[model samples]
Target chain A: MKKIFLSLIFLAILTTGASAQVKMLSLPQLQKRISNPDTVYVVNFWATWCKPCIEELPYFEKLQATYKSQPLKVLLISMDFESKLPAVKTFARTHKLASEVYLAQRKSDQELIDAINKDWSGALPGTLIVNGKKGIRKFQEQEFTYDELNKLYQTNK
Target chain B: MKKLVLLMLIAVSSMAFKLADGGYKVGDTAADFKLKNVNGKTVSLADYKAAKGYIVVFTCNHCPYAKAYESRIMDLDKKYSAKGYPVIAISPNDPVAEPADSFEKMQELASKKGYTFPYLIDETQDITRAYGAKATPHVYVLQKTAAGNVVKYIGAIDDDTENTKADKVKYVEGAVNALLSGKQPQVTATKAIGCSIKWKKSA
Candidate 1:
């Protein structure tokens, strides 16, 4: 019984340690994952500190579930620090989100800022809707409903 | 009838150049607003009536673009305030949404950076909307004339995006110099690119 309890404690600590580190996404890795010709990629820029981002997260989850069979990929890219990777994973697990979660690990904000959009002013709670073939549309805001999200997809398409 | 329709389309397209509703025009008397400054004291635009003009900048704490212009803005205030164009910086971001842009934190930054100008906070964001400010580091140069306060120039601080060295044009500074020389501003408005000011969510 003591051995089993020790193993359980070890597992708990292991998960906790894993949760704290942020997963950084390289540009090449991002390009590779999102380069699918069939999918319309919805890349959301969010952080735990942002309330509006938290509020609108469930809508993205719902959108993902609704279009699971479709060629739609919802990628939730957390702008949180690398050290907060574990906490972000916990947040994702707690919220029961099915969308692909990524930690955008850039050394400087400017690096990601220029990569996303030349016009991007580096605001949180931003989003990038990429057709992967046509073009990209970026938004800087806190809250957006499922209807708004749908409208963006339709208009872009 | 086709000619008339084309004329109407052209006229409608030109109308986009004018200020939006409730926005400050070239000759509108700017309404006075009391905002908490970096010093923890209230500062108003009217208080600078002693000056010939004002360099009103809407900026925030968290935006990287805002940070880029921090020193340049200070320098502009320092150089121009002596020449009668004082700079008044306002932060329009909601404190609850952006804690770094809160009043107390603004005060701290101003103190630490030794800001020569008033870094004001638009608590309700009314001042921001009045100026039609869309991004951080957005600039509006107003010259107090016998007629009223005339907006001389409204746009980006300079031509550089992220690199200060890349700045080839000084739009606001140039307009201020022209105003100081009693000449009409050459460029009235240009597109401003920066972080969008965060407005408070309706309860």
Candidate 2:
């Protein structure tokens, strides 16, 4: 009976971990998520080499937390190399990120740039807030204050 | 959500790079502006005139990203300037906040590196803004004409970071070649990879 109970507990734990696994989506899936009818999304394009992007990530998390009551979601899309996915995954795991995470799969900078925004001049820490009613508001750079974020949220609401 | 916040803080402390802009066209006349160079001499778009083309690059002293392209910038001038495409570099950061990017240090670095081009300083940070220069080592390639000098390309020096890869695509070189051959560059604008320009937050 002890052996059976232990096996059952192990199985339960495995299943739970599997269910909670983070999904890294492709561009198509990412676009679908962005275009989803009900889910308001905040998509941020960042890289590990960029200082400002790293500095402002915490604020994005705070913004995500503040909107937990709503159907809003935060997506962090890393522009790191595809080969660095392991490193990125380990980094994400180490950081304990709960928000949805993705690695942009575009090989060329042009492709990635077009994927984010046509007008973007390849600036780091770019952010896009998409809402059903408000459409999309994109910030080309970082250094956003909490009040500015809140104002964006408030206006969208 | 709270978990996410904790995670972001941890993530930030671990990594240093930031995302740069991508997906833009090139081949437009650059906006004219004047900025001080490292020698304390004011340089402007009108200063360097080439019958064929010119190169305007926004660079800084301390950024690792800028450091990566230092040699390349020198090479660009050495290779092309005599070919009627002189490269002009500008420092867009404030002297107070980033002392390494000051005019004095710029001269020191340029002299040490034996830079063949004019290294200028944008003291007011206005010219940097006018060009929408967001990062260190940002490049704008231009061509001179009877009408005026027109911007031919704007983007990274090459697709390689630290210049060590077979997969690297030399964007600036390709563009310059295209212009030399009197043909439009296959790609005008490219995504820049470097450090963000440290702009002062207004009081």
**Best-performing candidate as measured by DockQ:** 2
Candidate 2 lDDT by residue in tens digits, B135-174: 7778888778776667778889998755667879988888
Q: Give the Cα error of residue B146 in candidate 2, in Å.
A: 2.4
Over A1-157, each residue of candidate 1 has an lDDT whose tens digit, in order, gives 9999999999997666423333569776887877776678888888765556788888887887887787888889887656668878888777766677888776455567667776555555677887866765555443579999878777765
Give every collision pair in model 1. A19-A86, A20-A86, A21-A85, A22-A82, A22-A85
Query: How well does candidate 1 score on lDDT at residue A64?
Result: 76
Q: Cα deviation of A148 in candidate 1 (Å)?
A: 3.4
- Which regions of candidate 2 are displaced past 4 Å? A1-25, A93-95, A132-140, B1-28, B31-34, B44-51, B95-100, B161-167
Interface RMSD of 1: 6.8
Task: Tell me the tens digit of each residue's lDDT in model 1 across B1-203.
Answer: 99999999988876644544437756566656799887778997778757998999998888766887898899999999999999999998999878989888898899899999999999988888778776687888988877767777877777654443453578888899999998988877655335657888878
Cα lDDT of model 1 overall? Answer: 0.77
The number of the candidate with the highest lDDT is 1
